[model samples]
Target chain A: MYPRAFDYLVPRTREEALEVLAERGSEVKVLAGGQSLIPMMKLRFASPTTLVDINRLPGLDAIDAVNGHVRIQALVRHNDIIRSDVVRAENHLMTSTAPWVADPLVRNRGTVCGSVAHHDPEGDWASVMLALGAEVVAESRDGGTRVIPIEDFLVDMFTTALEPTELLTEIRVPRYERGGGNYQKLERKVGDYATVGVATHLELDEAGVITKAGIALTSVYVRNLKVTEAEALLVGRAPSAELFGEAAAIAAAACDPTSDIRGSAEYKRNIVRVFTERSLAESASIAQGS
Target chain B: MEINVTVNGTPHTADVEPRMLLVDFIRSTIGLTGTHIGCDTTSCGVCTVLVDGTPMKTCTMFAVQADGRSLTTVEGLKRNGELHPIQAAFKEAHGLQCGFCTPAMMLVGSALIEENPDPSEEEVRWAISGNLCRCTGYMNIVKAIQLAAQNSTTGGTAE
Candidate 1:
């Protein structure tokens, strides 16, 4: 399949990109990794009038450790995040979850910020960002920026809260000390989108009591599902198999999955339950050592 | 639109439509058919190519996106009229049957061994996870990559 013909604009600077976006607004689509947008265009699911190519823009690809947070620029690809020692050191969940996003080839070009902006229900980065309480920074033509929390950024399937003239510039993920995290996914085959995926992050106090807990589910909801009630159950409580089971049950109950070729709703809920338990157990074991 | 790209060590300039995919540009415009487009849906890695030393699915990227970048396709795997080590290994190991997926397999294998000279069996599987081989069931392909890693003195010379 071929993409529909569209005017392509290469912006060497972020300022140029913002100008193009502001002028074109709803008619323009920002091309970052081109992993998701290209496919949609080829399938004719999306036909934008103009494509503002930001891949050439410099100074937007760094993964830096800033003030108690790891700031990832919009241009930083998935493979870059996987290879970044700073990211791995700060949030091990990202490293473990990135490989599950897509194959190595796709990861070489797919950007985390782009995936988060695309807002696919099965996007691993979206679930991970929710589990980590990440924040997204969007820039506009007027040089104004808004930092939107991950929860507020994702609105619905293949939709985000980003304005028409706004471009995602950076993603800030808070750094946590003595944390243990795991991402568990069940897919039909390698490189396939997740059938059910769970991302869990836990921080233990000096006494091995859960001080912070974040849990999110993917591929089982209209949007990335965060089990805040389950997370609250974990905090201030000691790690135990029974407690993890309860949290897993809560996550399974919270998810609203539709039956498709992958599995039935009940089957996916069961997978979510099992994966959540396994991920929580693994995270708890690591938290004890951390 | 015009694009200047370095493919197979040769810099070429071409006037291509902005919507032209990199795989189509390489095959139809540059006349390098080694990179096959098995599935244009980006799920299949038959069109895998190295862009600036990184393996990328060319079908998902536009020709304009590849402007000013260097790309290495399967046609570049031969050095001085001889098969590259990875290609020779595939030949010796009988890693291919119909030869449809051979080019992408060899290219991805070369890139994988280049990154890790001593990759485990699991690592080899993970490296070529994107590229699919419907004929060989991947047993012989895995062996071919392992043989290439052992016999290769230098990594990924197809540059």
Candidate 2:
């Protein structure tokens, strides 16, 4: 099926794109990569009157690392993020999770920001970003900018708290203090959406005891959720398989999974438990190696 | 709007509607039927093509977006009246049957080999995961890519 007819605007700059979005308001959808938006449009799920194409906008395609933080542009495709040297060094979780997104062809066109904006509950990046304490930089046409924490960015299933006139411009992630992060996802097939996924970021003190633990679970809730209880259980404890299992149990109990084509709600909940354990264990290895 | 693009090494400029998809432009306007459209949904890689050395789903792109870019389709892979190594390997290995998916398979396969000279069986399988084969000739298709990677003339083996 074809999408409804709509006016297409290819803006050359971020300012021009914002102006178009502000002028069109809810009637316009910003097209970046089009891996997510176009498919939804073709399926008649999204019928915006205008599409503001931002692929040509200058300076929105960079991966910069400075001040122990990595700033990624909204237009950075998944493949480019995986190939980025800065992401490999500063945020290895992004590098590890990006390759498992769909496949090479989809990754070549899907952007990290686009996936976040699309707000698919099953998307891998959302949970990873949340666990890493990433900040989303959004700009509106009124020259106002707001930094939305990943925890508050997502409102519900396939919904974000972004305004119609707002454009997602950048994603900022701070470097971990001591340990590293890891993402674990379970998919039914090679390129299908995840049934359940977990992202864990752990930092240990010099004494080899866990100082900070951040955990986020996805595909098992309305949106990516931060499991504070699971994280609290990890603080001040040594990394152990049994401790990770307890934390994973807390994470699984914290989620409210829904039944879909992927699996039953109970099945997804079980997978979330397994993935959380795996992610924590993997993060611990990176922690100990450092 | 005036849209100009180099398709299969030949440049063409046409006045296309602002909403014209690149795949439609190549297939309908340019008459290069070698590029097939499987699912308009962009989920299938049947509309795959190379845009300035990078593989992209043509159906997901606008003809205007490709105005200044170079596009390589299945029709462009032949050189000096000889089939490209991917095409040669496919022919020798019988990598196709009904042939509807041949163009897209070759386009994605060739692009994968171009980016990764030597690809493992799993890597090659994952590279074309976006393309679905109803005839299920995947075994021979994998063999074709392996043979192509082995030939030093095709491109130096990657890994």
Question: Quick one: best TM-score, which candidate?
Answer: 1
- Model 2 chain A: lowest-lDDT 10 consecutive positions: A187-196
Fraction of true contacts reproduced, model 2? 0.59
* Residue A157, model 2, lDDT: 72
Every candidate's TM-score, chain A alone: 0.98, 0.96
Assess the local accuracy of residue B128 in candidate 1 as a C-alpha lDDT between 0 and 100.
87
* Model 2 TM: 0.95
Model 2, A150-244: lDDT tens per residue?
87888887888899999999888888767888888888766688888888999899988998888998788877888989899999999999999
Error of 1 at B132 (Å): 1.0
Give the DockQ-based CAPRI class for model 1.
high
Give stretches of model 2 more than 4 Å off.
Answer: B152-159
Cα lDDT tens digits, model 2, B1-159, are: 787899999999999876778889999999999998888876677888899978888888878888888999999998988788888888887889898888888888888887788889998888888887889888888888767766634563332
Best by lDDT: 1
Q: What digit string (tens of lDDT, one per residue) describes model 1 on residues B32-89?
A: 9999988899898999999998899999999998999999999898899989899888
